[model samples]
Target: MKKLQRIFIYTFLSLAAIVSIFPFLWMLVSITNKSVDVTQGRLLPGTHLIENMKTLFATVDIVPALINSAIIAIITTILTLLLASLAGYGFEIHRSRGKDIVFTILLLSMMIPFAAIMVPLYRMFGSISDTAPFIGIDSLGAVILPTATTAFFIFFFRQNTKMFPKDLVEAGRIDGLSEIGVFFRIYMPTMKTTYAAAAIISFMNSWNNYLWPLVILQSPEKRTIPLLISNLGSSYSPDYGVIMSAIVIATLPTALVFFLMQKHFVAGMMGSVKG
Candidate 1:
């Protein structure tokens, strides 16, 4: 009976995995085919991959857009993780009524739709442009600054931090480590899976962030991959092949990140459950 159950589970999982990966496979196949062939639902590889790539580059400044995305995502991820972890540690370790109230408020803020706050956020950033402006309008900073720290990530880290061993922290302090030192040396190192998990999630969020960036970055040159793909789609005569190629390119990094961090991500979540 157990063997039969195992067989059924394995079969179901294999099917589910194929179902999940089908769209990615389709996208890759479509990238190689020409517009007409793709429109006709051609599933086979074509010789037009190079042509599509060339046309994509010709139509848009893809290299710069890719660079822009990488910079924004990387910088935002680093800052988000650093700030969120610190905030989480603070909330978890230093128990105070005020901090509890603040954390609750922060979580509540996440429930409010981003669209509701977008106008105020736009005006605030725009005001910066109108006033002391270097890293304002249509800049990478505009995109990264608004969402450098996410409430969800803060909450995630805080929950994980609750599972962190307090004894290790005490030991570090006993060895003459300052509060900051203990966190940097002891806690940070011990929470490897949590950090890895958070890193991938935050990086992907920043990488694929569309709405706020679409509003903030108003220039062709400043566009990221998502924006670039959207613009391509809106053109009078869209090229499916090139668009597919662009999509595949845009998607690779996030997929790569997730694959690398899958083990750590699962371990981290399990650890969180233990707390």
Candidate 2:
């Protein structure tokens, strides 16, 4: 019976792994084949990779799109981590009614679909650009502003913070540290795993975000990777080889970030659960 169970589990896992990885494998195969060959289900690599890459780069402003994606993703990840962590720690440690209410509202915001809010958000951005004293429309800040406060990240941090040792905060306070200092010096250091997990999630979302970015960014010079990929696929006649190359390029950053975060992410989740 135990042998049968083990066999079943292994079979299930193998099937799952294949399901998850098949698309990526198909993408690589697509990159190596011509459009007709790819559509006809050629599953092997071909000599077309170099030609595909040449066409993709030549027809697209690949460099600028890549730079814009990297810039927005990195900035969004850093700011989301900082702000979300701060708010999470505050709500958890302060233990006040007002903050509790605010946290609940923030969590509720997570349930609101982006599609429902997108039009109003676009209008708000337009207003900010038109009347705001400082920044204007068509700026990168336009892309960054709407995402500064992410409900999901805030909730993730708050849940993780429940696992934080309050005794550490009390001890820091007893030692004459202010609330902010205690958060920075004591809590932050202890929650490295939590930060790692949050950073991964936030970075992936920001990096792969397409709709808001599509609406906010109007210039090809400032387009992101996802937009570039979509446009690459939608030109007069799509080139499967080139589109496949773009998918691979666009998918690499998130894959790298996931690998780096996975090492620490599981450990953090385990720690939180134990605490």
The lDDT leader among the candidates is 1
Question: How high a TM-score does candidate 2 get?
Answer: 0.87
Off by over 4 Å in 1: 1-19, 267-275
Per-prediction RMSD in angstroms? Answer: 2.9, 2.9
112: Cα error in model 2, Å: 1.3
Estimated TM-score for each candidate: 0.89, 0.87
Q: How well does candidate 1 score on lDDT at residue 71?
A: 96
Q: What is the lDDT of residue 97 in candidate 1?
A: 98
Could you say which candidate leads in TM-score? 1
Model 1, 125-189: lDDT tens digits are 88889665656777898899878887877888899988899999899999999999999999899
Give the TM-score comparing model 1 with the true structure, all chains together: 0.89
